[model samples]
Target: MGFDQYHEPPNELPDEVRTFARMILSLIEEAQAIDWYEQRMAVEKDKEAKAIMRNAQKEEFKHFGMDLEFLLRRKPQWREILQGILFQDGDIVEHGEEAEEAVD
Candidate 1:
């Protein structure tokens, strides 16, 4: 299997860390799939083809959400940081800074 996700030696990492890395890669791949479908939908002239692409994109969104939730459950600090940034109406950068500060 591909171990391209790891910068460090996979053998040296704990099982949980390895799983985290795999999930992170899966999340990235899902996001890429979503983007690809979106681009294809934009250029696609056929209405039925665009509808299929949209359906596929929706699946990717579900996959991305599940992956994110799994990662958040694994890392409480990450959850805390995202809680400060996500679903908020204010400045995102400001929220990020605040989240970091809140963690400290």
Candidate 2:
């Protein structure tokens, strides 16, 4: 079987790199799940169904966060750049620009 998450052959990739790729795939899946729930909930007629979707979406959020944190721990540059952009008020693009420039 082939895995799209890996650019190189999985067997040739080191254990850590393979694990990172798996987590990246997991994060993407979780984000997709969250988006799917949002779309379903928006048009859902039943209040009970909407509530269930929202609860499921929250679990996806946690999974995404855990995946992101794991990746960031292994990539210092990523952690550095996001620190300037995430959870901060004001212009996001400007913060991203500043973060990128700071890394240089």
Model 1, position 23, has a per-residue lDDT of: 97
What would the C-alpha RMSD of candidate 1 be, to one decimal place?
1.2
Per-residue lDDT over 4-73 for candidate 1, one digit per residue giving the tens place of the 0 to 100 score: 8998888889999999999999999999999999899989999999999999999999999999999999
Q: How close is candidate 2 to the true structure, as a TM-score?
A: 0.95
lDDT (10s digit) by residue, model 2, range 1-104: 67988889888999999999999999999999999999999899999989989999999999999999999999999999999999999999999999989987
Q: Model 2: C-alpha RMSD to truth?
A: 0.9
List per-candidate RMSD values in Å.
1.2, 0.9
Best by TM-score: 2
Give residue 103's error in model 1 in angstroms: 0.7
What's model 2's overall lDDT?
A: 0.94
User: lDDT of each model, Cα atoms only?
Assistant: 0.95, 0.94
Per-residue error for 49 in candidate 1, Å, reads 0.5
